[model samples]
Each structure stands twice: as C-alpha cells, then as structure tokens.
Target: SSLTPRPTGGISPIALPVLESLFTGNLQEARKLVFSQMLVSGQAAENGGSNNFIIGKRNQRALQVLSKSVDQDNCKTNALLYGGMHCKDLHRRLESMGYVAKKTEWRTAWSVD
Candidate 1:
C-alpha cells in the first residue's frame, strides 16, 4: 500500500468494513465487498477513506490487539498487522518470511513470496 500515484486500495480497508471483516475471519466475504474498488490513494483519502488504520479509530485498536494475539515468528499476517513504530523491525520480519515490504512515502505493500 503505497501513498504515491499508484493504487493503495486507498479506501476499501478502513473506511469500509473490508479490513475489519478480513481480520475478524471473513476475508472471502470482504473480497466480495471490495471487488473493483482499487484506485489511487489520493482519490480514496479525498473521500475520507484510508488503507492504514486511523490513529484514534477502532481499527487501530483492532490491529494492536491482533498483533499481540498472534505469534510474530510464525505468522506473516501478524507482521503485516503490526502497526508499530519501528520500520527496521518490520523489515527484518519480512526478510525472515521470504517476502519484502515496499514502502512508498505514505504506503506499504508486500511483494509476493
């Protein structure tokens, strides 16, 4: 999920229930809701949408709780769900999993494993 001109899914995750639904175990259903919704970050952010969890929102809490509940070493999903203050730590994690997380100023996206 980069913040540049490239697509970031910009909206579907936070503004919509897509992310919450997926984290809570309904990814397939969320897929249906998010179909064809991919677009530039500016467009979605302009409409009050976000790919990252809002600081004061429930999504942030959800991510925090989830990060703790799962074991980081054994879960790639946990690493992605981590909304921490350390980029190096996250980078190390991705490297361990044979994946790479690309950062683009305002967004991040994972490379295929």
Candidate 2:
C-alpha cells in the first residue's frame, strides 16, 4: 500500500495496539491516552461503580457481543452496528477517548497517533 495516512486528525483509541507499544517508549503519553480512554468509557472505573461498559446503548448483553468483536483484528462492526445502523453511544465512547473520527461512504473510521 501507499504511504498515505488514514486521515486520523488526532489521537484515537482505535490505535490501542499502537499505543500499547508506544507505552514502552513513552510511558507518560501512553498513560495519558489510556487514562483518557478509561474516563471516556463512562464507567469512571471508580472504586465501586457498575464496572460494566455498554455497547450500542443496549445492555450488558451487547457488551458481551462487542467483546467478541474486539479480537486480534479489533473489528468494531458488531459493536457499532445496532438495528442495522451505527451506534451513537459506542461512537461517543471513542470520542470521549479523544479519538478523531472520519465519516466515509463506507463507514465511520477512527484513528490515534
């Protein structure tokens, strides 16, 4: 493929794998990004919260299914797709994590760098 970038505008949680690697090099930045993502999860992940994350604004069941979509490939199709459409709540989670989003003819893509 060409060297052209993905038009990620800014950092995105979608690049979790990259961030994880970056952590070894720049621990501060990596921690910041990861912490931001945790906050964005809306789970707060405080001392004693629900400790559950929702997908597609549905229920815990959706989170269960979405987890399946987050395998090695990290394909979010099933997580974002609800009633044959994109899920706002799920997308918001990305936004809250400071991930830049881009809308294309095919689908909404996010990236972080």
Candidate 3:
C-alpha cells in the first residue's frame, strides 16, 4: 500500500487516523489489536498458499523505521512526529533502493527488486 502524504517536515496523514483511533480507544489495546490483525492476516495469506517472498531491502528499512517509531512508550504526539521523521528516512531509503529512478523523480513511484 502507498504511504499517505505528510506535510513537509511533518507527520504523514496516514498515521493521523491511527493515532486518533489509538487515543479515542485504549492505545495498548489498539496495538494489540493491530498486532493480532497482522498475525491473523499473515496466517490467512500463508494458508492461501502464498509464498514468503523476501522483502525488498527498501521495505525492510521502512519496516524497521516503523517498528522503532511505534514503540509502546511513544504517545500519539510522539508517534506522529516520529512518523514524520520516518517518512523522510523512508524517502531516502527508497532513493537508495533505486526506486526514485532519478533525483527529479522522487515523488513518483518506481519498481523494486
């Protein structure tokens, strides 16, 4: 899925809704729910006979950033700001992955290995 756009030097819009959902509900509970969803969804995919393809290097870095930012101690505001930083990092990572194609094409989508 495509990441949502963030304001320049700010949080991505995609994370905002998640933050809102976390706050309006129980944050830890929400995390547990999301984790469960990921697990169950992954299992469903596996049961459907999907092969476990290696994640592209760029995606691995992105996941790392996400994991670090969305820790249990981080609050909504912290997470929002962290996600902003992570999005910028992801941009650089994607560029290094050759997905940016050209320096001028950073905003456009490109293929991964």
lDDT of 3 by residue, 7-109 (tens): 6755555355456557687676557556656765765565322232222344465555655665654634332122222354456555665544333323423
**Count of clashing residue pairs in every prediction:** 2, 2, 0
Candidate 1: segments with Cα more than 4 A from true spot: 1-84, 107-113
Local distance difference test, per candidate?
0.48, 0.50, 0.48
Question: Could you tell me every candidate's TM-score relative to the true structure?
Answer: 0.21, 0.24, 0.25
TM-score of 2: 0.24
Best by TM-score: 3
- Model 2 lDDT tens row, 1-113: 11223577645535554465575687767766676576556433332333223233363455556566676559856434443122445556556656457772454343335
Please estimate how well model 1 matches the true structure, expressed as its whole-model Cα lDDT: 0.48
Clashing residue pairs in candidate 2 (N, C-alpha, C atoms within 3 angstroms): 11-112, 12-112
